[model samples]
Target: MPYSRLKNLWGGTKSLGKLKVIILSHSQQLVEVDELSEACGLEKIDLQGCSSLKSIPHTDQLKNLQLLNLSGCTRIKRTEVEKKIKGLDQEGGLKETKSESMMFSTLAVKLEPGDNTETY
Candidate 1:
């Protein structure tokens, strides 16, 4: 779906049933995904390159979520994302696995200064 112009994921999108994955990569204008938590079955959410995105919904309710790609999201703070994910892990929301943990770590590393220049 074309989400390049999307600013947020509110309203009707929360009602989508059986949505397993949503890739809104490079949606430069996107700033929020507050209603995304309603998609409990989501396994992957790729928001890579969404430079303007500032925050995502809490993951405590997304028990099935496996991959959450926030690479290149320059506007978001790595520490904040890590805090939220760590809380989710403690709550048994995301499935705990070495590779999954590594994925988040790598994404956090990529958020460092000068690392946001990669284009889609």
Candidate 2:
């Protein structure tokens, strides 16, 4: 439908070696999907805005992807994410569940507070 934000994005001519995670909140552009898939080498992708994004690209290529946040993304499919999650789960891989999934009141997965400390 709209082709304004997708201009000169997914050309696939860049090498993203240092990227780890990608958070596309309120970015309603489709042209960058492929480019992002190629550039970020992203392990965690948070698509919070794209309500029209129904498909995901290059799942096999993103072997390092762990957590995918699609909280507000109603249009995006869950099967792709589910498949990835299942694969990771089977292999005994670990993922950082977000604050919505778990309630720690401080951190999601003890990112700062270690096990030896008690804040009661």
Candidate 3:
């Protein structure tokens, strides 16, 4: 199922499974997934074009999470993202991917008005 639309399932109140990877591209505010990190033991997540995604979800519960791609989320401040990535990396309980240096990698790309840029 699409992670972005998970909230819509069963009227915005359903716990999800432990997702290995979640892609939220061109989505609106992803605040809906705030509880997902805790409920599902979420790991890798990609917020490529979600311009409305301004803040990073609290990820202390996502212990085993490794990779996160926030390339084109223009509303998200660079410093804030940097802090979140640094914190996640410091958690030090998961095996990270080779392509993902540290915890997050922001690929260079152009952001649309309501859409974030592209990422792998």
Residues 39-81 of candidate 2 have per-residue lDDT tens digits of: 4356666655455555555445555655554444444433444
lDDT of 1 at 58: 69
Backbone clash tally (model 3): 1
Question: What lDDT would candidate 3 get against the real structure?
Answer: 0.48
TM-score of each: 0.66, 0.50, 0.53
- Model 3 residue pairs with clashes: 49-116
What is the Cα-based lDDT of residue 99 in candidate 2?
27
Which window of ten consecutive residues has the lowest lDDT sum in model 1? 111-120
Model 3: per-residue Cα lDDT over 30-109, one tens digit each: 53345445544556666765656656665545555555656555556544544444243322122234533223236422
Q: What TM-score quantifies how close candidate 3 is to the native fold?
A: 0.53
The weakest ten consecutive residues by lDDT in model 3 span 109-118
lDDT of 1: 0.61
Q: Pick the candidate with the highest TM-score.
A: 1
Q: Compared to the true structure, candidate 2 yields what TM-score?
A: 0.50
lDDT (C-alpha, whole model) for all candidates: 0.61, 0.44, 0.48
Q: Which scores better on lDDT, 1 or 2?
A: 1
Higher-ranked by TM-score: 1 or 3: 1
